[model samples]
Target: MTVDPRAALDRLIASLEAHYNAVAGRQSEDDPAVDDAYDILADAFEVYDEALGTAHGEALPFYLAEEDDDEDDEDDEWGPEGDDSYGDGADVEDLAGEARSS
Candidate 1:
């Protein structure tokens, strides 16, 4: 079956938003699922940005820098070893594939 990129992007956004909302207004960190969803959404955004030249704006980089900081904080408590939640060197394509399979 063919997957529409736009539809996939929309799904990613919805999932990410839902995860965010589910954990809003709390002192605890975001769920690991939210982080995973964010990564996937970022990947989807990157693909769109590349194909449509939509990521060249200064805002994108600033947003990414902020996200990097958030991710760094998340990394401090994500796994049993306090390391990467998605394992070392796991690319977006692999996560995308897992999402598609599910």
Candidate 2:
């Protein structure tokens, strides 16, 4: 049977998000697969909203930084936070730079 790619994508994303939140937020149990999902979601969000150059909102004119180095302290970090808050502080740009530097 044929399937809608976007719909399938959405379902996959939802599953990942659910599992990721369950483990990361609740800390009920650690699953390696879900850990992988969390990692994948981090990049997916960036590409979907940020990389696409979409505006955050029409009313306010807010935007996501084009470069990770340009990330602000107030903005949530892109990758995993130690305490498991995905929105915690960590500069995505700085993180990217560190990755390249390595």
Candidate 3:
């Protein structure tokens, strides 16, 4: 069944409000309400994005970062214990300079 994009957008806006309220009223650092609201917000965004794309061939300006299962591979690429592959004191400017030279 196709979802109505307008309704989906309303749901997404409501979810955003709920998430903001959850964060504002959070009781502690590890508040479950905030986490629950965040999950709901993510779901609502996905639903709205999909409905909008399907209905109007349009999409939101931003997207949620998807969780990946290849975390171990990422860790390996960064070296043991998540150490960066870059040498000590390396920065973006240095990388940009090297790229320009090459």
Candidate 4:
């Protein structure tokens, strides 16, 4: 299967976040491993963010709301290409057409 970089990044971030949360319960504030995870997460996140910047000429969101993810296909809503919607975008043409038809 072809790997969608953005989707892969999303999954990785989620996994890392969960790992951090779990380790948080088991580790004290002074633990070096806890600090290491933060460093690793930051480095991994930088790769994802850099890929987003290089691939799309924009900063992809680090996280999205659960409700928004379910509202439409992530591929449809945030496809890596031909999806021009970023900040301040709402597909006015589509919206207007839908409104008129309704």
Candidate 5:
């Protein structure tokens, strides 16, 4: 099922407006209305991005950040002893030695 990019863009704009309204009229710090609006806005944005890419071979300049991972876990990939695995098979230590000798 293909979506019209223009329509998706309109929906995305409306969702943004709704989110702004929800935040502006917040009842409390933990307002469910704001949360719901944010969710809707996120969904609309994803749909619009997909539709725009599919229809015009172009994409938005930015992307929504994923919320799945814990902030502290970001550096786990580097590990306690940082291993440089440059996919091109360049030895980082050898490069550093060459730079120092130069």
Candidate 6:
């Protein structure tokens, strides 16, 4: 079946936005969760761009390139490594402790 890459990309983009909204409800844009979301979005676009580069008018499934697989496995799960929110274990509490010591 012939699939339109552009349509697929649009749908992916919409899904990402929805997921971001759900995960970041009531959080400031500067929140680390938001930053992680942007990084995820950027990574998604990079994958799409690479796929487009190799696609010859054919429907290519979007996937991360093996070469780009450099993130720690723990980081692959997304959302604070376990929590539903983002931070990478570097939340405001951690920052506050650092600031107090300095």
Q: What's the TM for model 2?
A: 0.30
Q: Flag regions of model 4 displaced more than 4 Å.
A: 1-4, 7-11, 60-102
The CA lDDT of each predicted structure is 0.55, 0.52, 0.85, 0.63, 0.85, 0.60
lDDT tens readout by residue for model 6, 1-102: 343557657856975996678476837646676667666776666655655655654434555545436454555434435454334556656667889999
- lDDT score, candidate 3, position 65: 79
Error of 4 at 73 (Å): 48
Better of 2 and 4 by lDDT: 4
**Stretches > 4 Å off in candidate 3:** 68-102
What are the candidates' C-alpha RMSDs?
15.8, 13.4, 4.2, 14.4, 8.2, 11.2
Against the true structure, candidate 1 has what lDDT?
Answer: 0.55
Per-residue lDDT of model 2, residues 1-102, tens digit only: 343445545755776677667576654366676677766665554444442343332122443445456444334444333232346444556667779999
Q: Please tell me which model should have the higher lDDT, number 3 or number 4.
A: 3
Per-prediction TM-score, please? 0.34, 0.30, 0.69, 0.43, 0.69, 0.37
lDDT of 5 at 65: 79
Residue 75's lDDT in candidate 6:
53
Candidate 4 on 8-69: residue-level lDDT in tens? 59866875985677576656667777667666766666667666667767676564334444
Candidate 2 segments exceeding 4 Å error: 1-16, 20-30, 51-102
Task: Provide the lowest-lDDT 10-residue window in model 5.
Answer: 71-80
Candidate 1 contains a number of clashing pairs equal to 0
Which stretches in model 5 have alpha-carbon errors above 4 Å? 71-102
Total residue pair clashes for candidate 6: 0
